[model samples]
Target: MSGQIKYQWRITKYNPDYRDENGYYTLKEEWTCPSEIGKIIDGKEFTLEEYLDIEAKYIDTLIAFIIESGLNTLRILQLSEQKISTEDRSSVLYETEFDELILEEDKIVTLNDIVIISKMILRNFVHCQLYLKDRFFAHFGWDYYMYIGSSEKSLSAITIATERGLFVEEIDSSPYYFLEEDTTRLVQWSKKENELGMNEGDEELLEFPLEELRLIFNLSSQHPVVGNIKIKIEYKDFFQRYLNHKMDFDKYEYFFWGGY
Candidate 1:
């Protein structure tokens, strides 16, 4: 051909324990092949095959590196929010690849010992296209979420709420409250006495512990809760006062974590 040629390669293996029915990975490492190998317009031009044959050696070098240095650690990051660190070092997630290099019958790491590696990397990527695709989905365990709020932060509509008695604010609306052994989903709502609108007074904080709050709702099948996701739910009723506001504990349910 008279024009320049570019390519890419895909290397994938499936483990039933780590993949779904369709073989999508639930845990995986990923990387990309190089693009831009300069131009054929004015540079010394060779046949496309000649160009590719020369480029293949670089990929070979990369595979050799994989067999030598190990892959990065897998971080169990928040699938819901982005955290900013205040340290001098800029922290970023490391890309992971083949978790534990599985060797062939013989355990060895070398280019000559292709039979030892569980995945065949050197032989792959020989003909892939040059552009990077959005393989964000390829990162394992990066899925599973129900988006809430208009903020850039994505919180699920539901979470395991525990430590039911104490609530502290994270954002004006969010609570830090999750790192405890307990958990919960934060739900946005209007305060009881007001309909939602920014100009209106800020909605009252939802710190009423669940134990006492449940009584106010007289939680029942008819209770106006945002969630019924749990199978085993029990009810308790108690009376308490907040600030100067006093109300019967038998008819209300403060915003439960399971709802919007």
Candidate 2:
């Protein structure tokens, strides 16, 4: 009593209009679980208990692949536009089950630990799937980025823009320069009194002297809207600091948002 099973987890969000008196939208989360007959995996039909075991094994295998492949860092992107906010390496570890292992100086955290924590963060915090390089790519940080020592040198962390119908290109300097034009981009700017009794604002992009990492965005004249802009960051320097505890969750949030 077994055949090939096509299984998937689905989440459906209702429109805002479909809200309850409490102003909550209807969200449906669904998945199929075999209640009677066994499900076929590979060439073998497996009972519920056996299927669960294989499912866990498959997940573990994927985790092992990520760790063994040296995928130590994760790029945190905004869900709506996939704007690369910042890189994450340690914060998830501190928040997840690996906290004590991470906090203890005597204990050494491994690549496996980092990957598992990152996966958990993406699932629980971001509510996003933990996608591999081939599955998910990013295209909004810097102009050009490559991992010096990895075989999968693709800019997976900065390819979302192109996939989402935006072209990416390189410019002379940091994209933070746009902060000058976009008032909201800056946390604050100085307003000076002008000769005409008007207030002239003196604005500058926020500076992070220790930051070798730069946020890169490609803005096309054709599509001038912020939604069309794709962004990413040079994460190597930031990741190094994160590993050494030189950067923490609070600092990461500040840097990600460019201040409060």
Candidate 3:
């Protein structure tokens, strides 16, 4: 119950006076009226439970429907057809968001109905550019969040390796594998691909090997100055090598990183 909860919507337009142990009055799905700060919903307020009810039951549905229907975030939020019952709380995406997506359902749609209906949209499908930290960032699409939950002990080990300085020097004594510390990357250059091994496949997203995923670490924690490094293998060549050795981190390093 206490790990990262996956959420795609950004909360805005809520009251600031209310505070939680986690430091917010409550989460709203979209822009709220500034005057509605005391309330959980943007234009109006509801109890925390009310908000949770909206999220647990309808949030995923909203994402699913919008992606399936190719609609805007606000349009999906406000759609009257999405409501299941009167008892269900109203949506902030509906209450405040103010526009529609002028889409004819793009011609190049993936043919998988189940996946189209089930998956949340990760990458932006439209053309866009952003300026962050003095650089121009451009992207036509973005990726869905990757969840790689591991055993606590394995995660602890990974965390340590990510922090280790000159970990490349410790390959011989390393328990799982060696981590390389590389120079910090530019923020604008990092968003073009999935930070974790590029989606497995555009359709199913079969998980990528950790070795491929691990190479992108520096892109994620860039400003923090954490350890990330170049694996010295071309991205095009990674999968061929990965499939040859069964894709386990074990000895893959003994073979790949250390080149032993």
On TM-score, the candidate that comes out on top is 2
What ranges in model 2 sit over 4 Å off?
A: 1-29, 32-61, 67-109, 115-119, 122-150, 153-260
lDDT of 3 by residue, 93-199 (tens): 23211122222111122224212221222211222111111111111122111111111113333333233310111111212111233222211112224454332
Each candidate structure's TM-score, on Cα atoms with residue i matched to residue i, is 0.17, 0.25, 0.17
Q: List where candidate 3 sits over 4 angstroms from the true fold.
A: 1-9, 12-14, 19-260
lDDT of each: 0.25, 0.29, 0.25
Winner on TM-score between 2 and 3 is 2
Q: Candidate 3 has what TM-score?
A: 0.17
Candidate 1 local lDDT, residue 134: 15
List, residue by residue over 1-260, the lDDT tens digit for candidate 1: 01111111122222235767874666644222212223342354334454344334333322332332232111111122122234312212111232233322111234433221212222221111110111100011112110111111111111111121111112221121111224333322233444442222112324556544434444432222223221111422222232223332233233323333
Ten residues in sequence with the least summed lDDT for candidate 1: 129-138
Candidate rank order under lDDT: 2, 3, 1
Candidate 3: residue 214 Cα off by (Å)? 17
Better of 1 and 2 by TM-score: 2
Q: Judge candidate 1 at residue 131 and give its lDDT.
A: 8
